[model samples]
Target: MSGFSIVNGIAEITDPAIYENWLDNEEFKAAVAADSSPERNAVKRLLIDFEADLARMVRDDRVQEQVVEVMTKYAAWDYVQHDPNAAGNGLEKLIEHFRNVPVVGEVSPPVVSVILDGEVACLMMRKPVPDPVVPDTTYEWNILTVFRVHNGKLAEHWSTFRKAVPGRDPLGD
Candidate 1:
């Protein structure tokens, strides 16, 4: 249980209790303190809104509203494609893939690790899950999200996903 402090993009959580304390501290209250820029607050609100929407998704096993809004927000944006034509690249296509699945299992809570360099932030997350078709098939995969945030708005983003294979124990060799 940890989170981005965002003051300088430093994330620190020594204990589960620390994160619990943070939940009660209500960091959003701190975000609302400075009243000079309403627009900045709006972006902050958007971040919170997305976070809340993600929570709802966890409960519902869908990302409909959030996906639509995010796609609209990124309209006319440049996207780097690993394989643009194959499956997912555009927001609609991404949403389609997830929606197309007969049973959309809840995505695991992202294990977030951030790399901060100046104003840029890269969040490396590992989200593992059992293959829906075969419950016994489980694997932990990596998803990296790079965000360029300026003035508190998500100006740009890049993301990629990877998976790992399991190896048999040495005694079998």
Candidate 2:
């Protein structure tokens, strides 16, 4: 048996191997299955669809018709009501940004998780960071994007980033 510690009433697995194994355990499956909320399920499906669209874009290195399809199906037309970041204000602007901006480095597969009982969802991943000073040394950028869901569609989005750091506690110091 692996040891775990309770931190602020949440179980913290002490070992990576144990944690990985526990992901496939029956109890874990049961717990996941017990969450039967329709909204939660819809969000999960939407996230999956979005991830597939992202994968296609990354793989093809271009935003195609499928990207628009996914966006139209999973995200609201006016996703962000008011935002300084031009890319997030509307679906058309976002697609334009995707087409114009060059992805800096290899994008890792995203890990999607639910938050706030289907009201919010998060996609966490890391990507290689370009280092101008030390080109040889590898660096990674940690990114977490949260989306607010409304009527089974993505209504709002926000993101946070940490550059070239590993094991930097995302929860804060």
Candidate 3:
């Protein structure tokens, strides 16, 4: 017979670092680099860059350099955005978007879900929500981001947002 135990109705994670390592691994990194479409690569870079920032939030802040680099790349891209916030090739809008996005000072790791179709990759992240009024507090959110790569750099990206409720409850319920 197999032994079983649960704490707070959740199984204790014996290897919590597994997910973290996977997110920061070379496999994902290589995939981002291999994305041939400029737009697609850009999207991958944004996430990669953000991943560093996120890790820093939980462990160290020096990773901001990588985040800045990613942001800079996004700023330089001359691509159209499907998001409503994006107006005219998106750099200014993206900057404004990040400025307005609330950042939790506390660690709130994201849960990533990936799906690939040909050259398009879709990544879904579920994490503590950003406070509606504060930039340093936590909330919950479900975000779906799509990227299309064409020559190693990102060429396009689109995102959808949903709010998350507390208590292990699923969002959109």
Candidate 4:
């Protein structure tokens, strides 16, 4: 645990505003891209072209069209999904599932950081859920998502999501 970093602990904005555009954060991108290996580069591309773009798609509700192109480019159609709340485990399912979601324009979810370990890459994000006891107040939770790169495409995915009581704190705090 010596190397583990904490986010959303002191405040809701533990991550800097630049992280919201991580791909464009030159220093952050340079630090990660220093490796320059094939697999690492592929994972970086996937993060930028697919995952980063996902925010835009969500904001505009362009789930079906743009998401398809990027998902197809970076992720395997048959990729394994470990999150219990995930829609399904295929490219088509990803598109179909998001199409039904409501558009939230550039609310700028906090993407804390991303790290790579061989074939696996982890994207850390800070999510805020409404405080159950205090209306208009909220608390933050760290969400870690891991993606495994295979054959230069995202082959598997996992996340820190769990079922919580209705209108309650997601972490049951």
List runs of model 1 lying over 4 Å from the truth.
Answer: 1-9, 14-52, 64-66, 73-86, 98-120, 124-144, 148-156, 163-173
User: Total clashing residue pairs per candidate?
Assistant: 0, 0, 22, 0
As a TM-score, model 2 comes out at 0.56
Worst 10 residues of 3 by lDDT: 1-10
Worst 10 residues of 4 by lDDT: 1-10
Give the TM-score (vs. native) of candidate 4: 0.65
Best by lDDT: 4
The model with the greater TM-score, 2 or 3, is 2
Arrange candidates by TM-score, highest first: which order? 4, 2, 3, 1
Error of 4 at 86 (Å): 2.6
Off by over 4 Å in 4: 1-28, 31-38, 108-110, 127-141, 163-173
Considering every candidate listed, which one attains the maximal TM-score? Answer: 4
lDDT by residue for model 4 (38-94), tens:
656656656644555677676666776676776777778887777555568886765
Sorted by lDDT, highest first, which candidate order results?
A: 4, 2, 3, 1
Error of 2 at 164 (Å): 14
Model 1, 41-132: lDDT tens digits are: 44444443443344345346555545556444532233333422224455556445334323233333332344556545555444345667
Task: Give the TM-score of each candidate.
Answer: 0.42, 0.56, 0.47, 0.65
Candidate 2: which stretches are off by over 4 Å?
Answer: 1-34, 81-85, 103-107, 126-142, 161-173
